[model samples]
Target: MDLGGNRRGVDMGPYAVRASGLYGMLKDLGHSVTDGGNIPVPVPEEIGVGA
Candidate 1:
């Protein structure tokens, strides 16, 4: 979710976390996994000056 810095694919954070098996692990531990889905993100061009 970081911007204005290194372009190391920070936008893929959610995918990476999911791919890490976190949800599966939690479910294996008998916990319910509720995926709230991705957050709303503004494209870089949508940022205003000094924002």
Candidate 2:
């Protein structure tokens, strides 16, 4: 989460990491990679200010 930051699109970090072949790279190194998938988070519109 962006926390108190005013930046938008910071949430896209996860997507960028996955697109960078992180899982594939780990597996190639003999590491087990299991994707638990993204956790469900409410969008900004679904949350009220100060909530």
Candidate 3:
């Protein structure tokens, strides 16, 4: 898969979610929920792009 350029944004999506306070918003909607926190995933450095 050739990821030409502009691939950095995809890697930061998860961090953006935490920054946006999604967990808190959902909890405020009067629904029981538990945020298990971020899942384990490898960064681009750890797993090099194979394009």
Candidate 4:
């Protein structure tokens, strides 16, 4: 949901959280970990962010 702003790399927040072992940590605590996967975001060119 981070689009059209001064925040670069904010779009990678989900990936970063997943890479930080969020699923593993949750599973370790005896919780079901079902990854829904990343949401699709439009490219800059697609939405004309800075172009």
Candidate 5:
């Protein structure tokens, strides 16, 4: 996972994954695929540390 981004909505990594066609490409190469969807992100407050 990323360190997250500077701005809100910068965490849109799942969209990037689909746009990059990672799942489809992997499946075409004979991989067993399933879209497991996204992981939950922590709220900034919960981090309790930052740069």
Candidate 6:
């Protein structure tokens, strides 16, 4: 969510990992993968400071 941070794009991490074939790689190693999906989080702009 990048709360209390100056940088951006931290929220894109999950998408990046999925695009890198993490699911397939783990499955190949005998692990069961389940896509729990993304949780809903409000952006900093939506909630405002100290919200």
lDDT of 2 by residue, 1-51 (tens): 665669998878878779999989999999999877778867778899999
Cα lDDT tens digits, model 1, 1-51, are 666758788878779879999989999999999878888868879899899
- Model 3 residue pairs with clashes: none
Reference-based lDDT, residue 40, model 4: 80
lDDT of 3 by residue, 13-48 (tens): 657777898867878997786766666755567786
Q: Which clashing pairs does model 2 show?
A: none
**Model 5 ranges off by over 4 Å:** 1-13, 44-51
> Against the true structure, whose TM-score is highest?
6
Determine which window of 10 residues in candidate 4 has minimal summed lDDT: 42-51
lDDT score of residue 5 within candidate 3 = 53
For residues 1-51, could you state the per-residue lDDT of candidate 4 as single tens digits? 576768888878878878899889999999998888877877766776555
Q: Rate the local accuracy (lDDT) of all candidates.
A: 0.84, 0.84, 0.67, 0.81, 0.77, 0.82
Q: Please estimate how well model 1 matches the true structure, expressed as its whole-model Cα lDDT.
A: 0.84
TM-score, predicted candidate 5 vs. hidden true structure: 0.46
**Residue 4 in model 3: lDDT:** 52
Q: List residue ranges in candidate 1 displaced over 4 A.
A: 3-12, 44-51
* Per-prediction TM-score: 0.50, 0.56, 0.44, 0.52, 0.46, 0.59
Supply candidate 4's per-residue lDDT for 7.
Answer: 85
- Inter-residue clash pairs, candidate 1: none
Candidate 4 clash pair list: none
Candidate 2, superposed: residue stretches over 4 Å from native: 1-9, 43-51
Higher-ranked by lDDT: 4 or 6? 6
